[model samples]
Target: MTTPRTEHLVLPGVLTAEQAAETVAGIRAVQREDGAIPWFRGHHLDPWDHTEAAMALDAAGEHQAAAQAYAWLARHQNEDGSWYAAYHDGDFRRPTDLSRESNFCAYVAVGVWHHYLATGDDAFLDRMWPVVFAAIEFALRLQQPGGQIGWKREADGTPVADALLTGSSSVHHALRCALAIAAEREEPQPDWELAAGALAHAIHRHPERFLDKDRYSMDWYYPVLGGAITGAAATARIERRWEEFVVPGLGVRCVLPNPWVTGGESCELALTLWAMGESDRALEILQSIAHLRAPGGMYWTGYVFEAVGDSRRAVWPEEQTTWTAGSLLLAVAALGGDEATTAVFGGDRLPQGLPPECCTR
Candidate 1:
């Protein structure tokens, strides 16, 4: 039985449950109609963020609303099985970009899988399978010979080598869901397992095959966060980069030597720490950042990145962000022993196509 002790949500030296809940409340207050949640009220909604927000809501037990969020995505999916990057709130009509992002499309699987686990609604899963199926097909187009996927598709269908380590890590997740959907339907999808394994291997063994943009925090931690890299290597990567980026009691910085720590990245770090079974440390990271929460359940995107006694400066606009809160809820669910986190953190290994690197002791 889980106790209601403050530490249940707090990370030892980090946040208390009351503080975490306050930030969560900030997130909940920003949900828009059409089931889209934005970074702030009056802000534009993006597909990746919307799916992430939906996952948080589902984990928080707001299943019905979360399902409606998925329904919104289904209704809006392009014939090619993609969604534009952004949409205006008041209109919710005009698309900001018609280009198809493979990484963006891949997130559908995560959202759908989370919703399914939360509710056990097979009917919902059946309705969503086609959407997931189409999206996976879209992701396959970006799969490269080295197994890391191309980043995005222009309207003209030109594929570029923007293959991000973080993006490919996400596709690894999408492939798992595609295979799960296939299994549920009793259909054969031997190819997905193969593709997933190959991609994971390229990421695990041959990091140079992809672009070397390690400056971004996502690149540093996502292999672990998205479950692509694991065990000692993952721990090593985090340890090696710890002082380079993490700001101690402040949260995670968006870039090296940048005097700012963003809530979204901080929450994501907490998630990664939780993934590594260091739940206490993960909770500590989350707790440290809870002070950023604003009224109405949202957070200012970042804080000043300065040493003790240095004057703080240039914080990003104070906004109640959907993804920021969503990431936190996902982390909380993970710490709370949610099964979805277990499956994700366990690396979703399939008996069929797990690469040699993944199976290594």
Candidate 2:
């Protein structure tokens, strides 16, 4: 039976009342005592994925747990308002990857704003405002003249000038969320508004500014998913490469010319479709990936559909990740009309920063 809290998480062919609870529990179980949500118990945690899982908890009515996750970010944030790309799960103080990614750092705003919307906690928003502000600033400092953000900074703090389509798209979404937070607090950040406009313009009209990662499914849909491309453009973009990245019942392929389908990409694509007002297609996509669901309500990272020599088609990598489950729950939440999830992904209620004069001119 679905409780009132998880009732909105129930989706036909996606999650049942009990199953939704289990999935929520599955993510929560992966969250350590200090609020760090690693991929799994022994795996590493990245800021973006950790934030995604935290947002899933919010969608499941686990507000306190979600807040804790945000608190963890606040506690561990680097002096420059960024986080290392990957942290060892067993010891939060130990960073396995020292690079700081723009998208990864910027994502705190999305999760913070989502948590605020889900809980209506003014104090939480107030407390997280600085964290979001600093993180966005760190990312925007690397924004190129073309408006696409540089992908990351090396361990030695050298900025990588190259931008990635998927990463910039994600950063674009985060900037809007950060702007929304500013709007809520009556703190108008004109610079952020202009930066957002430039970023969106780059993502929508200046793809050349970004590296060609088109072979990855994320590059195909992230611009749309990230709200930088929408309306007819979003629909056409999805349709243009639908067959190339989507593999029907198995889920979305991680990359082209590969027999691999990943649960994270499939769920994100479903979320993208839902955001495009194609709920029926979104539901179908979600339902199609049911085969990736593992026991205990977690989902395997991906499956390799094609057999290689003596190896049969199997769940490749053989790891069920918290972020994979989180992505699924978020997609189901959007399809099920969870207001917080809808507001975040729906892109209508969120503020659109002023259009850049460069793009307009």
Best by TM-score: 2
Every model's TM-score? 0.89, 0.98
Sequence-dependent TM-score of model 2: 0.98
In candidate 2, which residue pairs clash?
A: none
lDDT of 2 by residue, 1-361 (tens): 6798899888889889998899999998888999999999989999999999999999999999999999999998999999999999825678999999999999999999899999999999999999999999999999999888999999999999999999998998999999999999999999998888888888888888988889999999999999989888888989999999999888899998889999999999999999999999989889988998888999999899998788899998899898999999999999888998999999998878778765451
Per-residue CA lDDT of model 1 for 1-361, tens digit only, reads 2233223344334435665565455555676566767667777777788888888777666788788889988888888888876777613577766677888898898788778877889999999999998898888878888788988888677777668898898788777766766776787677777788888888888888788889889889887877677888889989999988888888898877667888888888888887787878887788778667666555677887564465556456556677877777677767877675455544554233456444531
Name the candidate that leads on lDDT: 2
lDDT of model 2, residue 187:
97
Q: Give model 1 RMSD, 1 decimal.
A: 3.5
- What TM value does model 1 have? 0.89
Candidate 1 residue runs with Cα over 4 Å from true position? 1-25, 90-92, 307-314, 345-352, 356-361
lDDT of each: 0.75, 0.92
True-structure Cα RMSD, model 2:
1.1
